[model samples]
Target: MTIPYGYAKGTVISAPSLKPTRRDHETQYHLHFSVQVADEVWDVAVNVGTNDSDDLLKYKLVFDYRHPLIQTLQASPAGKNDLTDVNALPALDFVRSDLLGTTGRWRDSAVMDGSDTPEPVASLTRLIEKALSEKFDVYVFGRFYSEGNGIHDAHMNQGSKGRYIHRPNSDQNDHNAVWQDGAVLIDCRQPEWAAYFAAFEQQYLPTDDLGNPTPSSSPIS
Candidate 1:
């Protein structure tokens, strides 16, 4: 039972902004950007970091990511689209698709609330600015909001373990699904594409068909 997943493609119309919030002793950092598809403006919220110092998240921004799915995504309709079939659609799957790279090329990036802009947010701002100036198409893949105003979950969505796994009544692990992963892909300058992928440090690789980590799975180094 996978959660509702989809992608939104549109043109950047507003400057990207970052907000850090603290609620119930937990910190969350979100990068926000606006996009106009047809006549509607949709909000794209990207998670940059968290307060988990021990298991810091792993992030990667490929400036020149090349994949066959880029062409398919570009041909899709603009605005928010809800993908029902995970196997048929062009959803992202870090472990299954190997979008980052076959080899071990992952990095660690953590953002905190501060007066100065962090590298992660700053880099995203630059890309959004460039897209605004060049009129490049911004493609966001994640879970669509129930209110139909925006989309989020712009990160990995599988391989949950320990407390992250779903309990009997909790929906925390509802996002764990194969081919329903989240990512941000940009059609920058013809023939060039930028891709952003993120995941928690404790998420294991070699997930099962259902996107759950197997007994022999291991965390990315």
Candidate 2:
């Protein structure tokens, strides 16, 4: 995918790293990039893949700011004195886990709910805007996993367990109408960023066969 924002040129300053996961059978590979946009410093992670052959590809973009929730909590009276020291402040475990995969079930729950507030989609957009205004460097990470096969019944005695089951593929041309699913973050930190996003919506976002914004594929379950 083409990067829409054109603030400053970015460069890859670090090599990729491979790390072992807590799971005995799983491993992960991570790529890092240090970007210099104007005088600002930003870091990005790309192409994060897992050792699990069946895992799908995923991506994340992060910024260098305190988590909104933690910041809010720290301002409250009960947490005010307790978190006086920045180092002693309670870490926003939820945000950290979203960016760096963690074993806690919270991430899974967020994904399943679909309507969860403070969705990553909005967070990403906010980050872009903030970055543009402060000229802070922004980082983006992408990951991919092996697509899973179709669902099956629970039959303990079945000998076909190892066989590959075929599932329908997602239509590339379909654009989900839902805001969380359809919207892409546009670095609207600058006027150009807004224009870029507008152009993308007018040109590439999928439309119905009749040339409308409606999608023609099955809705995500």
Candidate 3:
């Protein structure tokens, strides 16, 4: 996979569109933004933010981005730019990538419910939905596709299977670690941010349109 990692901020290019909750097809809420860094308009998508439809994510709107580690990442040589740099800040090493680890951060700070979200989900959804057209800076990691672009793996880079070039594009390997990964951080001028941390699911997930689980030569995990 040719992944790009970088930081960008700009105006919302359009109202975020949602993909309606579903048991399949990976529900999402996506929008386009004019990023200042690349001088390009990019689509940013956030997943349902739950292990499943029945789960409620822990969503928090942080008003600051002064975490020492985050600052360190921004200060790294590869932090600001470099689209395809595997070592860029697009992927992080600190997040837990399990599907449902209680300590996992993926399920945090996002609205997962629909027009009837409840409690924290309700409130969180309102916050995100209302942030449209607002300017915000995001640590982004994504791949290029012919269709609409997405904000995939906007968090820690390790533990998730992805592309690996062992010898300059020769073979395929399970590169589920930091080296071939990308990480990001989202800080809003609200000084508040809707951090888009991510994690990969169980190996049995539907990862391909050809009806094949990724890296699976066995019986689909």
RMSD of each: 2.6, 19.1, 7.9
Q: Candidate 1, residues 37-146: lDDT per residue as tens digits? A: 76898888887876766555677887878877877887888876777466754877776665666324677765465432665666777887898889999898888776
lDDT of 2 by residue, 1-221 (tens): 11111112332234322222333444533233344533444443322334454432233332222233333332333100111112211221111123123221211101212221323324333444454455532322111111321111100100111121112243422222111111112232322231101011012223332222333322111
Q: TM-score for every candidate vs. truth?
A: 0.87, 0.23, 0.50
Report the poorest 10 consecutive residues by lDDT, candidate 2. 150-159
Model number with the top TM-score:
1
Q: Kindly provide the TM-score of model 3 when superposed on the true structure, using C-alpha atoms.
A: 0.50
Better of 1 and 2 by lDDT: 1
lDDT against true structure, model 1: 0.76
- What shift in Å separates residue 25 of candidate 1 from its native position after superposition? 5.4
Can you write out model 3's per-residue Cα lDDT over 106-201, one digit (the tens) per residue?
334344444335333354335444554454444555433335434443433333232421223443332333323333345455344444434334
- The global Cα lDDT (0 to 1) of model 3 is 0.39
Error of 2 at 8 (Å): 7.3
Which structure among the candidates has the greatest lDDT?
1
